[model samples]
Target: MLGIALLAHWLLGPPVVDFSHHSALSPIDMVATAHAEVKKPLTVNWQTLRELDYTTGKATPTVLNLLGTDTAVRVPGFMVPLDDSADAVTEFLLIPYAIACVHVPPPPPNQMIHVKMAGEKRQKVAWDPVWVQGRLQIVEMASPYGEAAYILTAVLVEPYTD
Candidate 1:
């Protein structure tokens, strides 16, 4: 009788869904659904970037309108560790280009994301590439080198293949 009950529960129980992390929503689709109001991951366009003040390096707040706000998203980028290590990182900057913050002048605010990874599972920094999944917040952050228009509290990390 116990065995039969267990089998029935296994077959009829609600599907186990992991609620601990963001769903697998593509960045592009997320933006499409947002319809320009702050709702999802938005692609940074350097071409239309509002030039920052050179002295203050202050970002024009107008771009903040395009921000994804407090929305879940996944983005693929190269890690630029702020923890000061190339092999491991807990806090880092994710940029559209691998050499973005390291070699050249960091791009404008919208072009980068300040990522504070969750927990002590320090992610191994790699030049290969990675996909960061988490809730994105539209906020301006200042660093010595550059500014980021958004910050993400990463919940999932995965190696990028393409």
Candidate 2:
């Protein structure tokens, strides 16, 4: 049954499964694990954060004057539909606001979450909150939407409260 389900998920996509009953790990627990993984500090120059304007399609790169050694932070974000298919998740971008994509494009690349699932539950499209564990690599990369943007490479996407 598990194999069949996984095969179906791969072929048909993720949304076919229901996760309302799924259990997720807490943010604190995930952080503890991430702390153990962290060997050195990663910093992002606030002034270097690039601001993109979709309306005009203009990009402005400036230096940020802020006080902090840790240039990256992992925060909880809701998953929004990136593709038309119910099962397909084209990309996972972190939003600062409850209605982030609608109001804003996205945070700097340092804030992006590139999640890597751990186990079986991780493979499934979890409606439950999952921790986006990764480092904040504020660099430019080609985006499906066009123009490389700031993003984080999520190491482990854990479960969390919605």
Candidate 3:
């Protein structure tokens, strides 16, 4: 019984788990690491974006507008491939979830970002964590679903590393 107790202590004691060490990262360190993961290049306010009915063949702008020319804003999001092929990235379904493309229908193209990588096509990293920086562009575009809607023009895309 004593030997079992000593073994348990050896495995689960302070020597194995040291939370009180001063060198341990503080809350501020974690916050800084998170901050480094995402950067806001440009933003369009919610009032400026014009929502259009994606279901209809005839494109009509909705009264519920959220983005415009002057209202700059930044939104954090993740990218999911529309197609099954990992390399054939014709379009990306942007969403708040790390794995939104698997089950979720995906955010509207306006809310979704169309990232155009600088220099070369952005390498595909883990899909879960990435920071997209770009300007919200209000323009008529046809989605892969054959619906026309406004889309955010993504200028840059980079993987978020901790």
How badly does each model clash, as a count of residue pairs? 0, 14, 10
Tens digit of per-residue lDDT, candidate 2, span 26-134: 5565445445434322333323333444334344533221112343344465554334545634355543334544544555444333332233222334454455544
Quote each prediction's TM-score.
0.56, 0.37, 0.42
TM-score rank, highest first?
Answer: 1, 3, 2
Overall lDDT per candidate, in order of appearance: 0.65, 0.42, 0.46
| 64-86 per-residue lDDT for model 3 (tens digits) | 32344432334456766655668
Model 2 lDDT, residue 105, Cα: 56
1 or 3, which is superior by TM-score? 1
CA shift at 142, candidate 3, in angstroms? 3.6
In the range 11-48, model 1's lDDT, one tens digit per residue, is 36633542223545465653343344333344433433
Measured with C-alpha atoms, the lDDT of residue 59 in candidate 1 is: 50
Flag regions of model 2 displaced more than 4 Å.
1-73, 81-85, 88-90, 103-129, 141-149
